[model samples]
Target: MFFIYSFTADTPPNICITGPYKTWRAVIPADTHSLSPVLYCSGCEDHVSVSADQPNSQMETDEPQSFFAAFCQLLFKSVRYICIYIIEFFTGPKQSLKGNHSDNKVNLVLLGMSGTGKSASGNTILGRRQFVSRTSSVPVTTECQVEETEINGTCVCVIDTPDIFDDEIESSVKNQHVTKCKQLLQSGPCVFLLVIQVSRFTDLERDILRKLEKAFGSKAKEQTVILFTRGEDLQCADMNLEDFLQDCNSDLKNIVDQCGRRCVVFENKTSHKHQVTKLMQKVDEMLNKQQNQ
Candidate 1:
């Protein structure tokens, strides 16, 4: 007597089956079945009876076939790896706005009152018009904005934020802006650019450093760089950066001193690259000092 065992795609409904085993049939003679009347499924411990006379007798095979089992196992592994690759291709690695501090990326957050040319300064640093900059009586940037660029092979991320220190703005809204800026930092090293006009310091900006500390915590002043915009006004007065700072009022001078005397002047109207270069140098030096401490 002869007995035939068949396997189908849906026959072995078990999790142990790893591959598509469809229409696989094997023949066994009843005389041979007396020694081993049962055969186990490939990659599965479940056994099937192939008895002619008793039809319910189950036994295990001493040795199974090699080539067919090896093929199924190899196919399953190949399919699994292909799926993993496809998933990784669609959802790539995660990256922050400026990347981590270990990557040597610079994150510059521009903070100041309105009409201080903060957006213009951001455009100048990126060498492009990334943020909207125009003269207006009210604030132009109403939300936190970010732009990134590569400077001398160093990655730089510039975050332009609205005037959160304004009394008219709601505290909730101001908190939202601060929260967004912190999220962008991604726990990396950051330098705040406290933008101030060259010749247009107002009473509103007198206690700006204190406001910055309140918003960004105590370490704000230590990691800050005084960015003075509208350098053309200084040029028209025939005054250089050092001369202007020397003649500045005691209040402004004190603010600059508290920021470790780190400052840079930018003439946004001009296309000069030296001013941006100077600002990046100041930022790099401040970051290095912070790292050392």
Candidate 2:
């Protein structure tokens, strides 16, 4: 007997097998848009019509491999490749007139106070775990660290910095971080990702941006993107991103306006696959607009 399920959906269907777990086949490609699972009992064998709008949930496997299992694996692998290609068209770099991947490379600097998930957003964009996060009462990132990664063959450099505006630091230490930022931007044109917690907005963020204004001039906002971390704060309720931002306090609006009205929300805890794609798409859209102008 076999049961097929998908892990990439919402409203995921879960069927209780009073007995034991069995191998399953996913009728549709596993993805974020998948709906809950629909179990096909071994005896029933009704060909369920999977809806494209329906999303599946993460599936759990408990049995050993079989010939059919191998075949199913190959099928899904092909589907994954296809999906990545199509999604890359939107979320990844754009193709050039010469049919080559476009090259309007930009360095992105992440700025925010401690515990704002700056590094986490960088890891999500780079498609790997490239930075660390801390939940301590005190700040952890002591120096600026730079890492280079690629998405759809476009090279990107992500610089993660310590809390430049941490209260514990003196002017000398603050300038050290400022120097590091210049070095990171040495490669070429760059953008900034201003991260802030979703639950609360603070004046400290604005004060830091004031310093950034001095460094990059008023143009920094044009190159900046506001990334709100810990999106799980809105997970339970049904809310749009704009509504979430509108509900923010005065301090948040000041920061948002400084970033040229560009913003992306992120959940650093769980891997909600599509969020990264959506974020990068917005990032590319901003860059593309700037290039055209």
Error of 1 at 155 (Å): 0.8
Estimate every model's Cα lDDT from 0 to 1: 0.73, 0.64
Model 1: lDDT to the true structure:
0.73
Give per-model TM-scores. 0.65, 0.61
Which runs of model 1 end up more than 4 angstroms from their true locations? 1-103
Clashing residue pairs in candidate 1 (N, C-alpha, C atoms within 3 angstroms): none
Count of clashing pairs, candidate 2 = 17
- Predicted candidate 1 versus true structure: per-residue lDDT over 107-204, tens digit per residue: 89999989999999999999999899998988899989889988877778899999987877899999999999888873346889999999898887
- The 10 consecutive residues of candidate 1 with the worst lDDT sum are 27-36
Each prediction's total of clashing residue pairs, residues at least 3 apart in sequence or on different chains, is: 0, 17
Model 2: how far residue 121 lies from native, Å: 1.8
Write the residue-wise lDDT of candidate 2 on 199-251 in tens digits.
Answer: 86666665767777765577877888888887888775566678887877877
